[model samples]
Target: MAKKKRFLKMKIATLIMIAVMLVITGCSQSSGTSVKDGSNESKSSSGTLKIGFILSQTGTFAPLSEGIINGFKLYLEKHDGMLGGKKVEIKVEDDEANPQVALRKYRQLIHSEKVDILVGPISSSVVYALRDEVEKDKIVLIDANAAGDDLSWSKKSDYVYRISFSNWQNGSSAAKYLANNVGKTAVVLAPDYPAGKEVLRAFKDAFEAAGGKVVKELYPKLNTNDFAPYLQQASAENPDLIYAFFTGSDGIRFVTQYKEFGLKGQIPLAGTLEFGDELITQPAGEAAEGIITGINYSPYLDNELNKQFVQAYEEKYGKLPNIFSVQGYDSAAIIDKAVTEAGSANSEDLIKVLKGISFDSPRGPITIDPATNNPIQNFYIAKNKLKDGGIVPEVIETVENVTMPETSPFE
Candidate 1:
């Protein structure tokens, strides 16, 4: 498996270079058009388009980031690595899931590396820290996984484009699902951070509006390992269910502990998508089973593009594609479409094209809202189920063309 993964990575990089060269050759022979257009003055003058990826490659969020990287590579592999007749080059920098470090790396990539396009940091805090720099640089920043609701409207910048669901969609979709399918009374818990706060707020507001009752709300500090106190508080309140959002190490620890506390199956757990992530579920073991959550993508989704993606992903990496990987794949798809439709990799042109871009993604059809630079895609409710001796996410419900508000107060 290790050898195969290495080979696939090498193949993705090499094939892209080879394909781009072929396109460059074709362009030179047929069209007198030069790859170096004045639109890319601030960008590298070389015909090759450079993409800078800023995500956690170490620490707790690394696995999620790895999915994004793999998905991006797979998309490049399928397309032979050429985007709009340009040889695309990728430069990656690990932020270690730290905002300060992410900012430093973002500056380095923009200045020294001279990457024309910027991808992501999975942590919302990291994204917030780098927002100013991203705006100053004016490079297209593709949000691969961070679901900070503020990004949609409040902190919305023309330079940013997101393929993933927003925090509002993430939280509210789960609330809608739980209220209709499960019990209407629940407790909401989230880490006290931008993304968490936004997600919790969205859930609380929607659940109440949906004729549900929020028994309690808890905000633990970011990276809290022991959810015992929080769990105890929930048990005391004794709501019909528990709706919470957690990711990274916190998620794994929370579910395991929740089960240990003997509340797993009894209370009926439900929350935002991250808790249902494969990375979190497998580690949490049987603790995660029957946990209902909502997401925009799931390997269980049935569609031609999804089937092709799942098959290609499994063959290449020996695993199923998750929300993180699908987000990365969609990011690449967006880049490919924008670069093609804009007729150049210039930031201005790319932004214009991306606003109206619509394509069939692994999650189904998606379109970017020009006003907010966020996606309009299907929202899915997934239940963690034990399948083939392992925990897998199965899509049970799908909400199509879900979008964010024009103005997000959280920004």
Candidate 2:
């Protein structure tokens, strides 16, 4: 009986010891730890900067997302796979241009992967959905392509900063130039979505303010397979010009159908940046020719920085870089700059450094407006002219230092 009791006690002691050892091992494998010197500073276990991208890799926004990812990877390739002088680990999730899917990916990125920075989603709808979540999670999101105007206004969050142009900038940038050069009366068209509505509204306000009139406004459902009906409606209006905003496959189809419907030369076709970008023009071919647009970046820009960028991009990808590509490249550039300046990957540290950050971009010198958290950059009034067997934007006029207002002009 005495030997049995002693053996049982020894077994219990061994089990307890094993349990304590397992707990210690688990703690050592945990995410991070605070400084032992009584300071509140915390550090990650691996000391690697982790970035998560939620992009539309398999939907309408795929091309745009591809450009963004390509540009980001190019930057990494040039910098030895590092950002802010620290090695970067990137995890990309396909949001499929859907908001709910983006939310789920966001959770995985934040909780499971523990990424330090967040980027992307080509859809403005997805950006709107992510705005609240990033704020709640206290993660810094660098907006690569979503351009909804409300992101800089009513729905703005300190946690979110846009590297792409806003709908307001997109719509209004060419309004005055087109109103003066193209015609005084125009028909405006965009898909019936938040970005579409905001863009048309901006164009309308600016065009009217510049003494021009919008004769009619057309809102077609997104991804309209045929723009023949809208083209007919705009043609029937007999306006001086037609201004439209469409992107991705929609942009390609609209430009092609606009020419097929015989409204290309009869009524001047003017549109936002996407109309002038190579993504649409290369595929649309002759149909995209002679269109006037307001563009933020083009491979044809005359500058040493842009020339180098074009050469490097072509050498690597065997293709020309578009505005979406510039947005992606600048997205990585801003992160590298911010992280370096902040000296920490924490959201709090990055936010402080990102405000009013300025850098020389392939587009031109770009500054983040401290007030609106939107980019203050240049807009080019360009006309698509065929050269070298391809359509390229010919700069007609340069609008410099185009800035977004701190408050919504609509409000």
Candidate 3:
């Protein structure tokens, strides 16, 4: 009887030891830490909520993406590196401005990294390519920069949201400005893509609606470096004004070539807000003066919020915040608001909160359209001016708050 009791006690002791070992193993996994039985030492564990950022960090969209990332980081820093009381981890993947690469990186971010949220791929093509994949994964994708109208209209998805103004929105305002203010006989040039096509269409529709005419239209290849031929064609057209939609370095090249061809003052130039900011203003110097563009946000915007944002941005980056930066910053703010309102980090909950959510922006109050998941906001008409030997864009007029027209083809 004594021997049997002793054996039973030993068995119970062994079972307790095994149970403790199992608990330790489980804790290691849940805590995101590795443990080694041989060392008999437990390492401190840390938890992070991973956020995937896919952008053109090294390619054509680099300049824009860099601004987006900077704005996002600035918001994260202001929030003290925590979102909804969870430590935030930003994992960056360079798409190199290629749609295929962006798609691959997105898959990796979802399947491999298991990120909680995903943002970016600054090119419209990249955004379109991965939209389906992001929907399938049920992840929230906040587009900070891409402005293709199709994403907000025909290809709209519940999971995808855009904080920036669409190319069509800018195009519509540009058309209004040209028809009502500048008056008819305009030559239009944009890249051969959905965004460019949509901008041209909006401009034409609005211009013609206002009793104006598009004298000539040109579609340039996205990578074309030479604008000489295009400029010569535009000059031959002898339109009252020249309207363009080139972005990034292409914008610089186009305007520089326009000056070279002596079309600068002979014919006034106007375009989407992409051309109005520091990117073109500072770099193009005197050449950017007198150019008009439609904008969503300007550092010179007369709002208390904008005033603070511009001051903080200049103090940190030593430059004025561009539209991209404002959009990116607002994107982070929207996400933060959604997370707080939802009271959870769950993607679906956050998404529900995001729908119809409105926030005060540098551009003004912007609301996410439930049907399209895009922002409905105001557009600005601005002119580039040479101030203090630096090119600065001053807002000439506010076009007032314009919503997406019901007749918009994409819708």
Q: Which candidate should be chosen as best, given TM-score against the real structure?
A: 2
Across 127-150, the per-residue lDDT of candidate 2 in tens digits comes to 999998887877889999999888
Using all chains and alpha carbons, the TM-scores for the candidates as numbered come to 0.87, 0.94, 0.89
Ranking by TM-score: 2, 3, 1
State the local distance difference test value for candidate 1: 0.83
The pairs that clash in candidate 3 are none
Can you tell me which runs of candidate 3 are displaced by over 4 Å?
Answer: 1-48
Clashing pairs in 1: 16-81
Predictions in order: lDDT: 0.83, 0.90, 0.79
Candidate 1 Cα misplacement greater than 4 A, ranges = 1-45, 409-411
Kindly give the number of clashing pairs for every candidate.
Answer: 1, 0, 0
The candidate that achieves the highest lDDT relative to the unseen native structure: 2
TM-score of 2: 0.94
